[model samples]
Target chain A: MIRVSRYQLVLMLVWTVLATGILTMPATMATFSVRDTWLSSWGILLGGTLCAGLAWCHVRLFPDRSLTAAMELAFGRFAGKLAAVWVVIWLVITLATICREFGVFVTTIALPNTPEYLVVALALACSAYLVYLGLEVVGRVNEFLVPIAAIVFPLLFVLALRWFDWTPLQPVLADGWLPVWRAGVVPAFAYGLEFSLALQWVPYLNNPRALPVDILLSAGISALVLMGLVLITDGVIGAPVAYLNYPVLEVVRAIRVGKFVERLDTWYAMGVVSTLVLKQAAFQTGLAEAFRTLCGTRDPRWSIWPTALLVWSLAYFLFRNSADVSRFILHTVPGYFLFTAVLLPLLVYAAAFFRGVRPASRAGAGEARR
Target chain B: MIGLAVGAAVLGVLFQGWQAVRYGDGPGAGAWTVWGMLALAAVAVSVVVQARWWPDANPLGWLAALFDGITSWIYLGWSA
Candidate 1:
């Protein structure tokens, strides 16, 4: 079993949440709750914390097993297998969507003439290789890259402060709480529910007991970063943020720190891509592990290539363009994710409670005593 | 585009076939075969749709439309 420190896991989760959410959340939130977009981010933080708390409880209940194994323990053989399969499918789809979004972002913002599939293939190839190397390498890569993101992200926002206008965020909650609630639901489910995926990693951690704390810390940090991004984007571009494909990139491009600091979008892109790699690697690792656990494969590495290829194909063919991708993220993903991330955990915990399932270690001790 | 699709289909089949032969019969091997077949089928269908029947029949476009309709319905009811 590969062991990763809680710090590494925290960094990995933070990068995973920030890398993707930063670029898209602003525009998505602004679309629904124009001036009160920042409030939606707070909603994500709170919702994510609740999801993370539930995941932690699930992990504590079955300390020795993965999420799949725990599901089997809680739901019984056939039904648990069915649920596991569904979760695996959801994980695969999430991986594909993230890969697709990364490809679209890179192609649209940077590589205009290059084919989107090529970018996706290259990105997936790198992430697949990381998955093959195993989770330790993924954690290490995040440890190295996340600090750079941490530095560049704030600096980019601060430099863009020159264009910040308070009027756009004025008359906060002007649209009533309903739109804010709706707007918050997207990011809340997208980023918050991501902690549910992290449940699978708990068994591999050096200190699983620290997971809830790490989850809360990562969620808090990511939420603050997202809030900053939304605030900066809305403050800088105002209502126009909803119109731009990548409001963060646009904000970065608008930054004119002195004369030489112009066109920092390349730097910003590098940071984003680093996070993308981390996110994709983390998801790919989870997918490979899920395949190994579900299919009874001898080696998880064997599943990595097949999963990567499937992700590549799906990402390539999933949406007509980025707009379609955005629509799915906004309109569809939350509901699906709520089922898997929030409701599924609650169900598993309730089932485990009723079944009187003890922690694996305690159960083993009892068996030995008998 | 046709060549690319055909190439992807052929490559997927070959890759999966190689894995099945190397790994022998197991769940992993079966999964490889299934994924390979799915890829092959997807590409083959895309080629048929785009190259022969309708010149502008983008498989992804069709998929996007279907997905959008389903998701919109799920989230906002039929009126949306």
Candidate 2:
């Protein structure tokens, strides 16, 4: 199929992880770990990289099969289909939740006059179109967008140094390591394990052997950026970061370079939106592929529109407002994602090993039989 | 709001008709039919909600409220 360069894959992974977390990570972590929020991020980085590494091993063991096909090979046909269905449902819900998050963020912060449904509808339209274009287009688009984010993100950090206060992060481990551990769970599940979605793209990669290294490198870079944002938000905004809904947005809003460079929050918003588009494209593509596996279809393009509509409807009517959305994100999403992303892979890997399933010689050919 | 709902319903029906013609009895025809029906139903419900036809009978709102209630109970450890 669709082939993507290692560089494209790394950029896609980094952008997808950074998309939604960048805005809320600091505040969410601060709420739990307080001054030790940055430390908690380190735990997330390590956990996420480990999860990626585990996924790499699984892919290496079964180079031909997508995660869904591998599940079938490991657990037999019927049971594997059931597990694959669960993964697909998880992916669909995740996509809906992400769309809801984006809609709420835009309506609350950027475009108050717009209806949430309208914003979500437009986003779904764009993302669905991108998904229809296939993985190659998505990879290239990410290749273009990631560089802008890479440059602007660090520059924003540098400019905000005027407001950086290291005193707020003082007395490290004041509450001991438990709170930090608890705090790390949010980012660990939300950002780290999300790379599980990358498993779907393994077969499409040009050089499958490099997938693990690329994923690890991307996870490390994303972790550093996330940690930097948390540090800056906690330091500049101090303890109050715990109360702010979007601490990173506030941090960007506070940066005033003379008069011309003020209101850089708009720039930050643009970057977040770009990353979100890429993330949605990735999720939508994965969902389509999952559906194809389920329906025994060769093309997933026809499935994209229906899926987009379904996601839009669910995201629109699923929650009362942003508060409910946030509650779902904090309470429900972590556990749900952990089960699908971390535990499911481990289970599949164990099953595959116990069954002694050999790696296929040609990708997709063996998978087509099952 | 009612006008918007009506417009959405019409647009959804038109899109589905196009899809049905374009992909006649193809791989995704069934999906197109199901989604088209859902889009229409969702818009109709929105219209009803906007019109306040049943006053207190907004199913989508009720569903959201019910979910929130369940989540709160779970968060609060099911206090009696």
Candidate 3:
């Protein structure tokens, strides 16, 4: 059993904040059919945090068993298998999309000469190897990288102070609230808001009761970081940010603090690598857990390679290019996140309420027998 | 397994180089070329190190992976 302190858990959340996957969202959010992009972006905080809260509630209800196990209990054997397959497939696509996006970002800004596919393949491979090392190392690495991001990002924000125009955010509700809501889905699903991945590893918690606090705290922190990004990006780039493909990168490029150590985009590349790895790890963990529970693995750690290969193959085939990948994620992932992370848990909790499934009795040790 | 991963990584790198040469600033914009090579190299090294050399040791690979996801979120959140 890998032991992780509360501090380490918090560090994990902070790393999630730094993920490159979320970094790419502002560009998508800008196209959100709304003038008040920032407002719509902030709206995700409410929806996302509520989803996190629901996850906490489920953990409280199921305690020992994970969300996957709870689904099996609530839905029965056949449907449970169906749900598991959907989730596993969902996670794989999510990983691939993010991997492809990371590749796109790198090639777009840093290395224009590099092949985008190579970047995608390399990112997936790197993330898979990292996942294969197991969770404990992942946690500690978060502890290390999270601080760097926490410091660097704020510093970047501050240094870009001169370029900021507070007036751009005015007339905030200029285009009604509906567009904002539509835009909110992009960020809500795109970021670490899909806390469904938490269900996979929740069973590994040494003290499951303490998990509600971890989940809530992590969710809150992620939202705040997100809000900071929205506000800063808007203030810095203005409304035209919505029109650009890589708004944040462009904004960073636009920052020139008067000669000597400008072009901070390369430094930002480190931040990108950190986040891509996190996204891959979370999805891979979910995939590994599903395999462990369903297939009865002799060694759970051994599952990462085949899973990586599976994701690599799928990503290679799923969509011809980034635009197709974007379309699939934009249309499909939000509803899926809404269902898996929030609705499913709530339904399960409601069932647990009536069916009398004790939360404390759901442990892996206990469930292994069933 | 490590050897296989390394070989795939090498192929990925070669492919990346080929794409970069063939389609300089094409629509894919060389994103595939660069990231593909990186994915292959990084995955190959980490797996070889973990699976072969220190199979039981928990090193820092997992945290590195999770951090990747988190950074993506942060990037998207702040980018716009």
Model 3 has how many clashing residue pairs? 61
- Spell out the clash pairs found in candidate 1: none
User: Candidate 3, A85: how far from true, in Å?
Assistant: 1.3
State the DockQ of every prediction: 0.18, 0.11, 0.02
Q: If ranked by TM-score, best first, what sequence of candidates would result?
A: 1, 2, 3
Candidate that would win on DockQ:
1
Give Cα distance to truth, residue A60, candidate 1, Å. 2.1
* TM-scores of all candidate predictions against the true structure: 0.85, 0.83, 0.76
Chain B TM-score for the candidates in order: 0.44, 0.44, 0.44
Task: Tell me the TM-score of candidate 2's A chain.
Answer: 0.95
**Model 2 docking grade:** incorrect
Grade the docking of candidate 3: incorrect
lDDT tens digits by residue: candidate 3, A1-370: 7755666665565455447535656767767642466665554455456656766777667776666667666666556655665565566667766676777778877789997767766776777776677766667777777666778877877777777787877777777776676677666654545655666776666665666567667766766776667777778888787777766666667667767768887767778777677767767776776644443333345446655664564454455566766655555555555556666677777767776666666434554222
Q: Summarize candidate 1's per-residue lDDT along A288-362 as a digit string, tens digits.
A: 666555654445676676567766766655556777678778766766777777778789888988888877673
Please give the C-alpha DockQ score of model 3. 0.02
Show how many residue pairs clash in every candidate, following the order shown: 0, 0, 61
lDDT of 3: 0.62
